[model samples]
Target chain A: MEIEDENNFKLRPMKCELNYLSRSDGSAILAQGETVVLVSVNGPLDIKSTSQSIEKATLEVLFCTKGGKPSVADRFKENIIRQTCETAILGCLYPRTGISLTIQELEDFGGLLTCTVNCACLALLNSGIAMRHMVAAVCCAVSEEGNLVLEPSYTQVQSASALLYFVFDSRERNLVTGFTEGSFSENTYEEALARCRLASDVVFDFYRDIVKQYSDVI
Target chain B: MKISIGDVVLPGDYCEEISQVAEKSKVIIGPGLRKEVDRVYITKPGVLKKRNPGTFWVDSYQKRYVPSRGENVIGVVVQKAGDIFRVEIGGSITAALSYLSFEGATKKNRPEVQVGDVVYAKMLVASKDMEPELVCVDSHGKKGRLGVLSDGFVFKCSLNLIRKILNPNCPLLETLKNEWPFEVAAGMNGRIWIKANSMRETIAVGNAILGAEYLNDEEIRSMCNNIAAILAGHVS
Candidate 1:
């Protein structure tokens, strides 16, 4: 179940499109390798009186699967996305309002959570919502032979011994969110974090390139 | 790709022209453009447009409507609470339309506004913190074209499409109006109320408006003709 590639540290080819949905305030379709996710953002809209926060906008994330009802795993992914995006968005600017992020899983080959996070960020940017800075997410896995693999596919994920996801902000490349599964040494964790942090540069650069492509039309 | 004015821009992308102009004089940065300490950055993915003397804004395709003052909008009366009617204008919150805002209305005689009726009104006070207020009468206390509309089909479209057809340069409405007699009221809230003599004509008008979203002026004219021909059974 091991995938031996010459460039194990490199990410898969990425594609991003903004304003994919006309109804949502902001929308984007993002793909990482075989994984695809559609994210839509609606907000600074009215919040329910009971759930409204007086100081800042309330962030709500809903994750939908390709079919059937959402499971507990989907809810977990929604929480991670909400927490990561909460820091990136300037919610305090729109008080007592609510910002809703909806993620639709198009295809899941692997790295679904990371792809979802990236798609949400792009959709947020497309919505013209004010934010302190942009965020990017990268996922990495450790093979049975202790080799680091970046952007692994579904088969590779099943064989991997340890998996880690890291989210970094554009301003300082600081760690905004991090999640890991499986047991690993502290040294391995730090090494994986550093590797994913470096790999995150590619995602951020992709974001710039996508924006630049559209900016040329102006 | 090289970026320039009128090109689509994204967040974190800055404009040198804006910064250079800001150094000499004050420049008004509108929506989608933000002024930082060092430079002016775009905060949305849309075409950057500039007016003659320094006003710059990004024209992006958006669906959600944000209430702004002095814009005519079509809203549905959702509630009849005391003197003020709560109207849903597709904003974050409902707008308040007072009974006194209508023409020829007094404390003794209330305006005949019922729930679920579509009204074309102008936004008087649209602020972020305060609820937006709507008026059906102008300063001259005349109803003019602002009042409850009856016997029409209302549909929703993107805010961008609404602006597109409302643009003075757009040929969609002009071409369609010549082909058939139809009345239309476009709201800044992305809602349109159109009335024609027949259902088929109503559907034709709606299709023409929706189809013209991504088409050019020439295409829109052709599309309107195609729709008209189809409605008249001229097209095989």
Candidate 2:
């Protein structure tokens, strides 16, 4: 469908809970539509001498799918999530340390990457880790009719000709990471970027509300 | 989006009020707030707070302990190397506690510190680049409330709860102290060491502190009262 205005383009329903886990320093479970990802943050913890750095904290992201060992696809997801979060984290504050994020996929209705990235950011915020800024991810799919679907479902993504995911920082709304699947034209990519960027504000507002809810009394 | 004091804030949010004060004279940007080139951005999510005379900070919740200098902390002695003892202070790195830093300790005289001994100490040097150091004695060579802690129960809580209970206005500790005889040493590292006459009382102290995490001042007082009633109204 053609989305003309900012308000016309909509995101999937999102549900989130902060600090959901007991043991981790900070944890969150975010559900975007039917997809749900639980993320827990643990860090500025000690690191082995071999992997330790003198300038900043080492970040490790572990992405696990439901009821299976991690695979190559999971590793790729880990790399993207790690890179997206590493840019926002202020690692120099605690040098010679490490931060580890464990992301668990509870459900996958659609738009898993977007949901996972957003959930990871929320978990980081709940952990109160010093960050330069926060990031929000959005996904858009180009259907066979050459129309865009914002935050499409699993069936929509399966039937789509092209899929695009973009993560934007909260400060400038600049793109932090972008992942593309299948083939799309230059104009189609530009349109997807614009639409996804507009949809990211919803993700950011969701983050603000969740943080306020947990830190309200404190 | 209301960038005002007592209002919730998020990363990348800037307060014009802080800059207005900074333009006039000087404003101290505390933790969770960073002064960039043009605007002062927030790095943490919480309520924005401004102290009198020009101080700005974000009151946020944190569970992990980031060591700061001159804060009291409870640490467990992990290893006793020749001149220094490694104490895990819940930070990324284990802190170094010199044997000579203890009261009456010298080259020939060493404090009887063993492995896995909990101690109340102050952060001597907590630089991010260097190893954190701890001391059990003050400048006056007195071990005032800073030494090996024995016969007590130690538990970990959120850093926010620790600060809340330690705040002068918080009623959790005030009401609990009046209800029972207990001694508490709260560490900035999110650890609370409590010593009471009985194990039940010690557990009660821990429970009261944990339960007060989400309660306001009035609720904290009532919770303390309720705990007292339960502990006292029941059999020994």
Model 1 lDDT per residue over B98-188, tens place: 9999999999989999999999999999877788999999999999999999989999988888988999999999888888899999999
Best by DockQ: 2
Residue A62, candidate 2: alpha-carbon lDDT: 89
> Top model by lDDT, which number?
2
Q: Give the per-residue Cα lDDT of candidate 1 at B48.
A: 86
Error of 1 at A216 (Å): 9.4
Candidate 2 per-residue lDDT over residues A102-174, each given as its tens digit: 9999999989989999999999999989998899999999999988889999999999999999999998899
TM-score for each prediction?
A: 0.87, 0.97
Off by over 4 Å in 1: A1-9, A15-29, A65-73, A126-128, A182-198, A205-218, B1-4, B36-38
Q: Compose the digit string of candidate 1's lDDT tens values, residues A7-78.
A: 345798898888888677889999899999999999889877999998888999999999959799988998
**RMSD for each of the candidates:** 3.6, 1.4
Candidate 2: misplaced stretches above 4 Å?
Answer: A1-3, B234-236
- Cα RMSD for predicted model 1: 3.6
Q: What is the lDDT of candidate 1?
A: 0.85
What local lDDT score does residue B228 receive in model 1, on the 0 to 100 scale? 87
